[model samples]
Target: MSAKTKNKHDQSESPRLGASAFSARSKRVTVNMGDGQKVKTLTPKQRGATTEQKSVAKDVKKVMAKCKEEHDMRLDLSRCEVTELPRYIKELSHLEEMYLYGNRLTTLPPEISSLLNLKILALSENMLSSLPDEAESLLCLKVLDLRHNRLKEVPFVVYQLRSLQTLFLRFNRVTSLTPEIKNLTQLTTLSMRENKFKELPEEIGYLRCLSVLDVAHNHLEHLPHSIGNCNQLVTLDVQHNELVDLPETIGCLTCLKRLGIRYNRIREIPAELEKCSDLEEFNIEQNKLKTLPEGLLKRFKNCSSLQLARNQFEEFPSGPPAQFGPLTSFSIEHNKVTIVPFGVFSEAKKLTKVHLKDNLISSLPLDFGSWVQITELNLASNQISKLPDDIKHLTKLEVLILSNNVIKLLPKSIGGLCNLIHLDLEGNRLESLPAEIGYLTSLTKLSVQSNRLTVLPRGIGHLVNLKHFSAGENNLTQLPEEMGTLESLEELYLNDNPNLQMLPFELALCRKLALMSIEGCPLGRLPPQVVDGGPSAIIMYLRTQGPYRAMSFS
Candidate 1:
């Protein structure tokens, strides 16, 4: 056979040969050519195989070269499912930023320390059991986020990151912080909320540059006195903790603008807090404070708004410095206050709003009218029986709430309050309204529900701007025919009046009237004109037997 045919036959038989059989017969062959400088050429089959193998090898080399360049480049692989870092990651000497959030990474390779240029490292939402010792070597790291992890304790080496400015470890199981945490002098913000911290480290004061410290929703029973040493702190939220009392050193936070201590067991405030002159907002709500020291008011004289509701004070204190005139809004609702101090408001001339609801006030001082600048007053659920005549002096009063009181009558001088916009006297024993009430031309809302009123004054029609009038559950037997003059009236509640027999036909003239409720009245039907009037009127008529029921004005 020819050489080519012989080579093909050998290739076909090679597959049938056993591994040992083929190796036993394999041998190196040397051939000599006619020229003295001999040259041996491969057979046709061997040359084709060698050429193909070389081409594949070259392609693989090109691909491997590209992968090396990528492995050495900086990468931001945040929020991925990478279980472990590539071994070549150690070659990335230029890597500056790395984010590995929301992964199942259990441990980091010590080679991470090779990244000296890294500035931000986020490894949050991972199953990391502990940090590598080389973590401290990241000198250029500025921010570190490891929140929502099972970290029971922070590594001591973390304190060596002098360049760290912000650190977050929220929703972790950390029980204590190392005193070395204070070594992070460059840190400006630290969040460790929802932890098992029993108390703060005394060295915490060493973080003089910290502006925000959130240790809320923890097991902290007391704060370190050094906490007040953080002079630059502006916001401190320690709410939902077991703190029974605050340290007097808290007053040292002169730069604090907002302080929240709600949902704690705190019973009293530290008198040193009076020194927080720069404080603009302070919330101690939902505490066990029985009374506030008068000095606190003098200290926070610049405060414009204060919330002291849900406390144990039987009476509000009077010693808030006379210079605390800047106070414009005050709330003492839901307290044990039995009476408002006689002249408690005399010096509060700048006071614009006062809330005294849910108290035991039986009477108000005759001088209560001295709050001339007051615009809103809430005296609901009190025992007040009468208002002083001087109430007319409140010309600027726009809202007056006296609901659930025993008031028998309103001062006829109420008409002098031209600025009164809303008057609520619901749940009272009022028998009648003074005719002068009609002088409230600016009145837009009037509520007299659950009263003993028999009739409204004839001048009620003079309030052309009245948009809402509710007299439900009263002894009203009839409404004044002139009530139709309220061109702007939109809602009129007259239900539960068993004696009311008829409504005036003039109601048809109220072109803007929208809702009219006479459901429980003795009237059987509405006037024909009112029923045939514009679609804007929605009358809820009752079914009753009476001569007025058949009367029609059409």
Candidate 2:
């Protein structure tokens, strides 16, 4: 399947109850940055405009005149490349919102504090290393965006903003937060990703209204136990940190919904997390976990996606099927699991995606077919040798990747997957494909490379939508003349099939055939020039010499 189509399918099936869904700052941002709220930047009138005083003065003059004439409450001077604000900016005291992002300002004029009614001030992407003392006078200010700056610490004036609700300091040089941060009791969203913080002050728990707190991509070794005091938190992302484990107080966050702790050095999950009943998305992919805490899965009744790839898990976590009641996507790839216990996933009737690739799985349980709603199933690089006939029940399966497996035979029931678009059977021991494969009319990409097949089923010609077909490194000789019916064929791989000695003349019917590989094959009847000239030249030779009328390439 094409990546666009696959992504569309994935998006439609996954639930959207994560942090981005709950944070107001994230929704208001014009440019999205992963799972965290970002600076709301605007496009400049001219790309890469310089910080010329004349241009800045002209733009500021026009904006000031408009505010004076219409009593406008919003002033937009963003991306103007201004180095300093005019001292007369104090005259715009009625302004309620101000945008000055993407500028060269290293300091703000004391006159900026004159906007006593200002609610939002965007200063992201600036050269400022600190805020002016007068900034504390903006008593009505609520949102302050200072991302992408050179600040080495949270400005002292920031702690004085009693009305502030959201604070963005991403991509800064800040190494620590003052205990005074507890002064912002109204702060709901605090995004400090990509910073140099080694630890957070325990005073963060003072914000009872805090909802979205993202501290990802930092050097923090542990989370302050005070984090549990913020009961209103919906999204807490601490991924890419050096934390060894979570504080037991985490269980007190009953309102928590999405917890992202991937790419960390955590060795075990604190059982306290089971108390967060609202949890839906739990990502712990690259941790050092060896086992799931007892009854942890059973308590997360709302979990829709669980990712534990690259962990030290040795077997499927032991639990009742009820733990998977709401699961739609699950991945445990790169583990040492040898088998999937029966009925483990039987209760997950809504399961649509599963990834168990690169494991030691030898055989899928017979109940695998129960996941009739599954769309994408990847079991590549495993030791499986055969598939159950019950696979026919997965009529909605689209992408099936079983590459590098020891499978020798495919059940004829596979043809029932009428929705399958990409089938990767590369590096398998298959001797032949079933004729029922012709029933897969939706297939666009098929791979049977490095197999022991001597001849393709005549059904190969029925795949009118097939674009990429790989049958190289096989035991094949001549291809079926029916291949001429593949009107959409674009690339064909027939390299390393030493038994192939002749070309099928009917192949000239595929007008769209642009790339064909017959390397490592001994076709003694054809001249070396014709073989070296590629598909276009070979097609021309077959048309003129064999029984077809000559046609001009033009």
Off by over 4 Å in 2: 1-53, 517-524, 539-554
Which digits, one per residue and each the tens of the lDDT, describe model 2 over residues 336-453? 8899888888888888899999999999987888889899999999999999999999999999999999999999999999999999999999999999888888999999999999
- lDDT, each prediction: 0.76, 0.85
Give me the candidate number with maximum lDDT.
2
- Model 1 segments more than 4 A misplaced: 1-161, 168-180, 192-199, 216-219, 320-323, 462-468, 485-492, 501-522, 525-554
Provide the lowest-lDDT 10-residue window in model 1.
17-26
TM-score of 2: 0.87
Q: Report how far residue 67 has shifted in candidate 2, in Å.
A: 2.1
Error of 1 at 235 (Å): 2.8
Q: What does the lDDT come to for candidate 2?
A: 0.85
Instruction: Estimate, for each residue in 168-251, the C-alpha lDDT of model 1 and write its tens digit.
Output: 777688999889988899988888877798888999999999898888889888999999889999889898899999999998
